[model samples]
Target: MSAESSGGQTPVEYIQHHLTNLSVGEGFWSLNIDTLFFSIGLAVLFGWIAKKVGDSLDPDNPKGMQNVLEVIVEFVDSQVKDSFQGRNPLIGPLALTIFVWIILMNAMDLIPVDLLPWLASLIGIHYLKVVPTTDLSATFGMSFSIFALIMFYNFKVKGPAGFAKMFLFHPFSANNVVVKIILMPFNILMTTIEEIAKPVSMGLRLFGNMFAGELIFILIAILPFWIQWIPGGIWAIFHVVVITLQAFIFMLLTIVYLSIAHQSQDDH
Candidate 1:
């Protein structure tokens, strides 16, 4: 964005505006409209494309979109096979969804930072952040969903009694009953922290990377018009790698976590 687009606002103000969300409601109850809009839109598009590809698959001779999607599906399935244990059919599709959906959300950073916001401005929408992965709510929303799935499969595979036993008795087993009882609290504390760390770290890692990348793009947008392309072009190229790697890491971690959940403590 040029200085002209700032409309008398300072550089800091311009950055702040670019970073702000079109949000509503109060505090935790608030929703980020742009984040939701782009994320849900991309998800629907992914679903439609997958449906079309599935409906039209030809084993005799696959080409074009079929070839491309099969590559992605097969790649995701390979990852699931490597990382997921036991038999949960959902793992394959869940990993694929996480990989591609996050890639779509992260790809929003590749858009010119000012393009969508400026377009929205023409319609009186002053604030818009297009990269949904940069939004904490979106990242954490996804991470927490994975967390729920981990819990579900843990219960499914291990049963509540087994899960409770693993939770309460792991990493501190003792031959003496008294010693085992003494270590239960510490085991519980450690287990809680590990479980919380999975989702918290997952969410923060995605949000931090995308947010920093988007901020750099916004900063590039505010540079002198004649010189903006140098940095913008360079960062955009590097960011393509960053976005794809982040999506892959997120997917891999989800698989690994679920695998752990599906295993007995003895298995671990």
Candidate 2:
């Protein structure tokens, strides 16, 4: 897992070391510095590319970088057109940002596992994890943000009374007051579980897949030098699809949830 001198460290220790994050705090206040560092760095990279694209965009004379940027924009726009409903100017850009940013984060897995951490050690940093998606905090942070947006859109589109009505009457309802009262608790419970599950499932699914992929890469690195390429190369090729798919799935689900949130009960 590490290219550094093993110093009699066991394989388990090496893996744990690779998995560990460099941090400066303890317990509840601890931050995964590596995840924050890489995630923010990638976000800045995305922003820079987006700015360049915007500054240089020319519909009449598109070529080279402009053409490539236009293709990416069209691709994200098409995805937004397919999944999102209703007129929301923000959704298109939001979807594009999510897709490109997530793909970049996922793409960090392609880096040599030991390269960054070993380099960091040379500069006196002890631990570093380059793949942000592998960290639960990073994944959950993104999902939670999406969840907040869903909640906001729900309120904005439905109004207070309609939003409250959705929780009180959804999944089970009755005409009689007493019957409705009897079903209210069940409805609320089911609705709460359903709402909470969205972010949990989204965050966990991404984290689980990336963590497994990262572990496989680590395991591959542990193999004999000559034989490592066989499995490593194969998994690396397969993982390119996985990283892209996870990003697309995240973006698709975000658009779907937002679309659902933007719809009224009457519309449904």
Top TM-score hit = 1
Q: RMSD of candidate 1 to the true fold?
A: 1.3
Candidate 2 lDDT tens digits, 1-268: 4333455567788789889988879987899999999999999988897789788788898888778767778988888899888889989888888888888999999998888987999999989999999999999999999999999988899999878877888888889999998988998898889988999999999999999999999888877677778898999999999998999899889999999999997774
**Pairs of residues clashing in candidate 1:** none
- TM, every model: 0.96, 0.95
Q: Please list the C-alpha lDDT of all candidates, in the order they appear.
A: 0.90, 0.88
Report the lDDT tens digits of candidate 1 across residue range 130-176.
99999999999999999998888778778888889777887778889
- Give the local distance difference test score of model 1: 0.90
State the lDDT at 214 in candidate 2.
96
TM-score of 2: 0.95
Distance from true location, Cα of 68 in model 1, Å: 1.8
Model 2: residues with Cα > 4 Å off, grouped in runs: 1-5
